[model samples]
Target: MGKNILVLTGSPRQGGNSDMLADAFIKGARAGGHTVAKFATAAKKIGGCRACEACWSKNTACSIQDDFAELEPLLESAATLVLASPLYWFGVSSHLKAAIDKFYAYTRPGCKRPLKIKESLLLICGADEGLGVFTGAIETYKGIVDYMKWQDKGILAVPSVSAKGAIVHTEALKQAEKLGAEI
Candidate 1:
């Protein structure tokens, strides 16, 4: 079955370099005939996880109502998830990090029925080059995949892409299309 892919953009800058990378993935995924949707964190007021712990008693649903309530249905329907964010301080942008933390709403109390995410992907872009500038973000994403038991689809890290449209030379767009086609 074709997957329902959710691409969440975490960059604050409009049409920032990282978002361009995500657009590549979205275009590719759509071309492959999968259902895809993209959401920009900057445009939405997604707050931090409320830590109410009320989720357990109410079908893993949260009580500190906000935009998060809107995401539950999306999560339920998504078979593949892509977290796209620009590298900030060698970690995921604040918005995406908060989104991840909010995922606790999906956790089961008994730990018997593990959360399910099916398949997942991560797209990260940084302004500097280094062996592991993305290590922190990658580790965070891997941790989420582990919790959800999602398939390890792929992760692409692009370095030195600060200026908008700079990714055109990095082949990240082509790679994203391939990722979509494969998924």
Candidate 2:
């Protein structure tokens, strides 16, 4: 059986390069028979975690009362998590980071809820031209995967793609699609 995949995109621009890359991945994932849900963090009003330690205390995944509450169910049910974003200041966008911070709710001490995610994939693009430009973002992704104990499915970092439609000129889109399908 196919897995349930949750794709969180962190690009503020709706049809930007990273978003297009995510779209390709989603297309391939769906064609591979997996159920995929895409959440655009930049478009939502999700705030950073408050670290109140009251996770699930109010019978909710988080008590912040924002779009994260809507994402809680998807996070709980996902068998695979895909984080797609554009490199911002040598790291993932603040939008995606906010959602990631809320992941603490699941791991809070004494919390009963559990995340079903077993594997993860990463897709990142940037305006810079070298692989070194992705170091910080890759490190952050590695940290999350390690902490969650999730299998690393794959990572595709495309550089030198500053313009919105510039990714079309590169092979990253096809690579992302193939990775999604294979996953």
Candidate 3:
């Protein structure tokens, strides 16, 4: 049986470089028989975590009562998570960061809720040509994988691609698709 995959995209621009990479990955994942669900944080009304520590107190993933409630079900059901984003300040965009912060609701001390995710993949794009530009984002991704105890499926960081649709000229898209299929 194929796994349920949840792909979270951080780019605010529709059909942006990062989004394209996500599309390629989704295409391959679907062809591989995996069920994929995608959520674009930029298009939602999600907010950063408030650090209230009141997670699940009211039978909700979060107490702020926003779009995260809509994502809770997907998060709980997904076996693999794919985070695709355009690197901002050497890290993930604020939109994706906010959604990631809300993950605290599931891991708060004493919270009984469980996350079904078993593996994760990262896709990042940046304007800088240097490969080092992706260090911050990669480190953050690594931290999340470690904390969640999920397998590190893979990471595709394409540098020097800032213009929208620039990724179309690179081999990263094919690599992303292959990565998805292998997953």
> What residue runs in model 2 are displaced by over 4 Å at the alpha carbon?
none
Tell how far residue 15 is off in model 3, in angstroms.
0.1
Per-residue lDDT tens digits for candidate 2, residues 46-160, read 9998878788878887877899988988999999999999999999899999999999988777666789899999999999989998999999899999999999999999999
lDDT tens digits by residue: candidate 3, 71-125: 9989999999999999999999999999999999888766566899999999999
- Per-residue lDDT tens digits for candidate 1, residues 36-118, read 87877766677887776666454546666666666666766778889989999988888877777777766747432234468
Candidate 3: C-alpha RMSD after superposition: 0.8
| lDDT score at residue 24, model 2, on the 0-100 scale | 96
What TM-score, over all chains together, does every model reach? 0.90, 0.98, 0.98
> Best candidate, lDDT-wise?
3
Question: Residue 155's C-alpha lDDT in candidate 2?
Answer: 91
Determine which window of 10 residues in candidate 1 has minimal summed lDDT.
Answer: 108-117
Cα deviation of 150, candidate 1, in Å: 0.9
Could you list the CA RMSD of all candidates, in the order they appear?
Answer: 2.4, 0.8, 0.8
